[model samples]
Target chain A: MDASKIKQGIHKSKGGLIRSFVTIENGAIKDIDVSGDFFLFPEEAFFKIIKELKGIPAKRGKIQEIIEKTYEKENIQSPGTEPCDFTESIMKALEDT
Target chain B: MNRWRFIDFGLVDIRDMMAMDEAILKGDEGNTFFFWTPKKSIILGYFQKAEVELNLANCKEYTITRRISGGGIAFSDDLGRQINYGVVGTIDNDLFPLDIIGSYKQICGVLIDTLIHYGLNAAFRPINDVVVTPYLNTGTKGARKISGNAQTRWEGKLLQNGTLLLDFDIEEMLRISNIPREKFLDKKIASIREGLTWLDRELGEQRDMEEVKGIMKRKFEERFNVRLKTGKLSEKETALTNSLLPKYYSPEWVFR
Candidate 1:
């Protein structure tokens, strides 16, 4: 039985740090946990953002699009962070194979 | 003219301090600022993983607590050396602008002005820190961090909390924090020493805590153009704090 395993990556943003741990199985995201020293309004939206990314194919642009869309849809105000920062973190994690 | 409640809770336990901040932010208050020096402890940000960010063995030597706000981990003590403050207020355009970045800048600006008025040349470092750039032989480009801040918003109220390192033990800070990875411990510690500073390190001596508080209070009042009445927590707030204490002490909350 094949199961997802965790891969982690950390990125230093302009003012803080972004750490992402992702579980991937069969080339799709199984689970993800994003934690850091950064501030994000609608703080609860963070967990939801991670959940939304689950089951999505591990493609850079697609994952980036979802991150940007979820933040906008949830009205998350993450100071000193742009969507690219998160995308870069996810991309790094996916490459951790 | 906005009225603010100023409470000076000296030598508090970290858990109780966190609970008090939660309660005040929940209450129907205009704005409140709490000043306190906590017993030696390491406070982890809300979203941080204690296992990843803290040196648990070192934490056992003191105390470990987690805050509702999200930011980096911090070391705080009650020896009248460091001053910790928590501000609770609504998200308003006039004072705490509706935008997050603006609010941080506004609050950091107040803190920078306050530190300068207190006879230290302080400046606001982007996102969430207050720092001082000292004249040195090596000529580091950026300033050294003297203060760190974090915030959490519940409903419409925002709880912005931070620490002012007056007289800190950099050695102890490095010992307890998960900084200076094993491979580069020596180099990292040296770099950290260069990048961070304390008030006493800049001023050359430990100053009176009360005098420091007075300066901070007066500066806050002046910057915000608000008068703060010295006060204590309301009965309801006290009760809420007591109830919330257990949550802060729980393993689930701390580890989460």
Candidate 2:
């Protein structure tokens, strides 16, 4: 459950599907990484959305709120692209801790 | 379709233009203006990590401000560098192709055609760059990159802005880019100038910046089939840009 350990795990899971991992140690996110294969759009574009999300401030008690806030920040309205579902996945990842 | 307004203010800050774009997207009164930075600066793509993309020492020594747009890093200085044109309007799905390839071909086609007017053989290279092939005997690929563009979509509007390097300092670019220094040690910098060229360089003299702007405006009008209207910054646009300028010029935004 060490923060460094979580960071390492997320960084190592650089597989093909668009996946994000948040490294939490002692109930606080220490690191995060979003990676995937060739996306319909540029990976850089998605990363930009993540960067904006990181700009917001959230308390440790508001983990789900943080995820939702970050997802809403992306503002992607393309057909079938659900930001809320994406946030759910991140919340699930955090809950796994 | 709304007519595109052209503002030709020379060497205005990039932050102002970005703020103006945001205001326009938010339905605030603002005129689309094209402005250039006076010093060499790296505008990191909106999503890029500034720490990863910019060299702090280099930017400070050279005095270039970073931009908020998304895409690869670009280095620019005032060697005939014209004001950057920002087209602000409602996002028209019809105007922008759904796919990246189609979009690149469409936007770059207009640029290539414009360059052809100046007698330079410019071509649209893949992944979103317009380049001219360097001469063979010159040991240059002749594929000099004349422009680099980036886009930002917000609310219901999209802003695509880029630069056309009229004349650039190769040494300054080499200092800022990810290219290794040793590679330029043995060859003339000009030889390696493939995928990069300037109108002034091609013409062997510094051409009038206003003339170049006129040509680009004409091309945009013809290709987009919209009249190019002349306008200045609206009061609301000016106020927004003024508000955003401090943050954009701040160390936090630049070094973030």
Candidate 3:
């Protein structure tokens, strides 16, 4: 399998049902979508958070930093999920299933 | 003493109802319970993709709308089979705890208690849902969902909304949503419905909407130790709803 090829995958959180879908190309997230029963405040932040991930490296540290910063700056409150949950989901999507 | 206002706006369209919720949360500072019955509509969550989760043709057949609240797909109809409940209030330390999940748990507890009062055992199924217990003596799955809930914090206030399914049109639901029957999506909807039980199904008979509302109001008062004063939408809230209705009914917002 080519590591840099564009790919799509889904990952449900380790501890919860929060799920994320990611489209990756050359180890970078090209697009993503999230949906679940989990609650995220400032409801508009749901789309904004996903937008912030575009073009970001798929590395865990980089993804984590971006998610945390976005949530903090936007005052987004997500119950049943943390910033690392999304970071890990994207990383898992990058991995071969 | 804790106090909450209970406002019943009767039947309304999805756009007006959703706008009213936001307006109350924006313009009011105290706790409020808003009630309304919506015409058949598929309410999508803020982050949900309409193309992937819903059947566009069916949505068109039976009007669809997107809500700003964060939650999974839910169906409601004005056939008196469901009651839409919305709670709007400031994020006050006095009314509820400051934690997000905690507040969800507390509100769901009230809902569960309401069901229990009706002799139908129910339980809170984390994040935001209430499920009724075993379908024993019947040939269906156990612990089915009777309620779906979601919330959002906007404009320094919290708006929590939920639907209590007194009855549901399963056929219509299957027709509208893209819930599959043999894959992951299948598993998702399967677990959701396997134990799904409605009020009429659980009670072995159809129950009137007023009866359900009366019991629910009493239950909330008992659980929260608050008085619920019957109220109506004020001029400010009504005006805001008018201004917000166009956006809610607009294609840009619904498809966004």
* Top model number, lDDT: 1
Residues B7-32 of candidate 1: C-alpha lDDT, one tens digit per residue: 99988888888898899999775699
Between candidates 1 and 2, the DockQ winner: 1
lDDT of 1 by residue, A29-73 (tens): 888877677777777788878888999998888898899899989
lDDT tens digits, residue span B75-182, model 3: 875465888888876766655557776777777787888888888767776667788876353422355778988887765577888989888877777777765332
Stretches off by above 4 angstroms in model 2 are A1-97, B28-37, B78-83, B98-101, B134-142, B179-192
**CA shift of B88, model 1, Å:** 1.5
Give the lDDT of residue B227 in candidate 1. 93
Task: Report the C-alpha displacement of residue B198, candidate 3, in angstroms.
Answer: 0.8
Residue B152 accuracy (lDDT) in model 2: 53
TM-score of 2: 0.66
C-alpha positional error of residue B165 in candidate 3 after TM-score superposition, expressed in Å? 0.8
- Encode model 2's per-residue lDDT on B142-214: one tens digit a residue: 4566787655555555556667778778777655654433223433343446446777888788877777777
Candidate order, lDDT descending: 1, 3, 2
For each candidate in turn, give its C-alpha RMSD to the true structure in angstroms: 3.4, 8.6, 4.3
lDDT of each: 0.79, 0.55, 0.74
**Deviation of model 3 at B17, angstroms:** 0.4
